[model samples]
Target: MRLADKVILVTGSCTGIGKAIARRCVQEGARVVLHGLETEWGEAVREELGADKSVLVIADLQDEATPALLVRTALDTFGRLDAVVNNAAWVASSNIHTTTPAFFRQMLEVNTLSAFFLIQEALPHLKERRGAVLNIGSVNAWCGEPDLLAYSVSKGALMTLTRNLGDALFREEGVRVNQINPGWVLTEKEIQRKQEHGMPVNWYELLPPEYAPSRRILDPAEIAAAAIYWLADESGPVSGQVVELEQYPVIGRNPPKK
Candidate 1:
């Protein structure tokens, strides 16, 4: 058990990558604090993981007070904290001309500002424990996807935050900070996006014969595996780095030729 006896908090964990990370943490002998806005799904995850091993903290990360409340809840229930995975995000697909100001503000508030506040609130506890912080971001942070303007921008800021904080805390506190960038994942929302774009249900089946990149879209467990590695003692020396999760084109490589 790489994370034995650790206490981990994962935000937006009722589904998708967050839920997967929480499950992996529990499997590694860690007590998990699950945070999310989804009440029914959060409770269901709590039950699925066993009530004794996991507890749900209902929070709307978009709110100003949520970060402090999350830290307090974790400490109140778990006695100490070992790690935090800032995995919650908001996505609104819009080009610059098409995006409303409110939409842009809300996207930043959810994706970037919330992370800033959470890190501020979690700092003292993380400093005390010499814990790890993993910020979930999109690979588009570097690749520059024009269609996902606001989301890409927010994730780009997240990448910068990870590097800057990792440098700031490494020498004095021994805390590690890192980012995980997941590629096109097969989540429910992604499926909806494909449908909206007029792709068939079996889109993968329709790929051209020459498209030789991995046939599988990223799985939640695969992302969770990377999360576990980042949180584990093995990654203590690795900070200020963005580790990507997917099959091909690992980090800096371009997409497969069309």
Candidate 2:
């Protein structure tokens, strides 16, 4: 049991990567606080994980109060907090012309600011246990596609946040922080997203070699598997690091030969 007796909070956990992480955490012997915006999805996950081991928080991350509420729920329910996996984000497509100031602000509020506040709220408890923070970032943080300008900027800032706090907290307060930047992953929403773009139901079955060298995108479970190491004590004395979970190099790699 890598995370035996620990309590973890995972945002956006009613689905996708966050849900997978929460499930894995429970399987590894930890109780978890699951946060998301959908009531039905949240309840479904809570039911799946069982009320004995998991509780769901259904709220919008754009709300400033949500962070503190999440922390309070974890402590009030589980008695202590041991880890936080910030996995929620408002992912939308927009470039300069379409990105209004209000739009950009909302992006930051949901994707960047919420993570920061959640971490801040969880800090004191993490210090007591010398616990960890695992931020789920995206490979798009390193200069995303043209359509993802605001989202890229938000995640880029989050990467810096992870590094800065990862160092400061670990050195000053003994709370380790790290990040995982995952590439394209196949999640329920992604399937719907691709369908909205006119891809067929079986589109994921045959991905191009360029985007998926293994002929497929990643699985949330794969990302969840890697998450346990950072959250678990096995990663000892390390912080301020970001790992890119992609099949091949995201930077400086030549395009696949046509």
Candidate 3:
């Protein structure tokens, strides 16, 4: 049990990669605070993880005050807070032409600002415990597809935030901060989202090999597995790292090979 007796707070944990991270943390003996907008799914996860081991919190991160409230809730439920996984995000596909001020603001508020405030609110406790903060970023931060304009911008901002805070906090407060930029993970929400976008029920099975280098898209559990090392003490004082979790090299690659 790498995280034995740790108290971890994971946002957007009702489903997808967030849910998998929470589940994995619990399995590693960490008590968890699961936060999400989906009340039913959040409650279900609380039940599944067991009341004694986990608690559910429903929040809309867009609210400026929600981050503090979430941190307080986690502290109240458990005696202390050891780690926070900022996994909640808003992903709206919009290019420059389609992006309105309101939409852009909303995307930044949820995907970037929320994580900033959450870390701010949790800083005191994390510093006390010398704990870690794991931010779930996306490979799109490098340079997203045209369809993911706003999302890519938000993630890129998050990447910078991770680096800035990881260095500043570790040097000053002794709290470690790191981020993982995961590529194309096949989660429940993703499956449904793709379906709604007109992809067939068996779309994943039909994906070209080029789309998935290993003949399959990544899994939430695999991301969760990587998350554990960062969140746990075994990572040993490392910080300010933005790991790109993907099948292909993300940097210095041209369009493609003929």
Candidate 4:
């Protein structure tokens, strides 16, 4: 119960990483607010977590008013806000020629703009509690994921936003901010997409094993663990970092150190 009594707001919590993070926060004793576009699944999560403690805020993050509403609901329900997990994201696998203007806008709205607005609205409350903000970034921000160009670009902006906010907030308000760049994770959406497209998950064998050091998709819970750390006081002095959660190290030298 590292996060005991803390109030956390997690976006896109109906499934995947967001859902995993919300569950973990609840298990660790935090009062959580779960947001998602899916009404049924969001309500189910709220019930699963016990509606008395965990409320569901159903709203499209692309809407400008949703962020403020989420914050207000948290304060009204929990009396205060302590942490935020900006985990909502959207990605479309399309090459340059296939990508559309609307596609880019959707990606930026969900992956970047929503984060910006959430942070802006949550800042006043966060500053009051000296709370933390955990931005969900992606390794794709650094790696070339040409198929997900718009998503990659937006995630890059999110990474920079994390740094900029961390620096500014630390200096001015003493609030902690950090980012987690997770590697590929096998979620229900990925599984369904794979089945629908008849893509082979084992195709990774075609590439050198060293290219994908872990050799397996990351678990959402693993990523959630990292978020939990950032939300806790134990993460002291670790602000402004972009921590990558992958099976293998991406920072070490290409060849042997010797």
Cα lDDT listed for each candidate: 0.86, 0.95, 0.93, 0.87
Output the worst ten-in-a-row residue range by lDDT, candidate 4. Answer: 202-211
Q: Which stretches of candidate 4 lie over 4 Å from their true place?
A: 200-215, 251-258
- What TM-score against the true fold does each predicted structure earn? 0.93, 0.98, 0.97, 0.91
TM-score of structure candidate 3: 0.97
Encode model 3's per-residue lDDT on 1-258: one tens digit a residue.
999999999999999999999999999999999999999999999999999999988889988788888888888989899999999998768997999999999999899999999999999999999999999999999999999999999999999999999999999999999999999999888888899999999888887756776778899999999999999999999999999998887887555445
Candidate 4: lDDT over CA atoms? 0.87
Residue 179 accuracy (lDDT) in model 4:
96
With candidate 4 superimposed using the best TM-score fit, by how many Å does residue 173's alpha carbon deviate from the native?
1.4
lDDT of 4 by residue, 54-158 (tens): 999889998889999999999999899999899988856876887799988888899999998998899989999899999998888875477878888889999
lDDT of 2 by residue, 19-106 (tens): 9999999999999999998889989999999999999988898777888899999999999999999999877889988999999999
lDDT of 3 at 146: 99
Best by lDDT: 2
Candidate 2's TM-score: 0.98
**TM-score of predicted model 4?**
0.91
Off by more than 4 A, model 2:
none
Instruction: Flag the better candidate by TM-score, 2 or 4.
Output: 2
On the 0 to 100 scale, the lDDT of residue 208 in model 2 is: 86
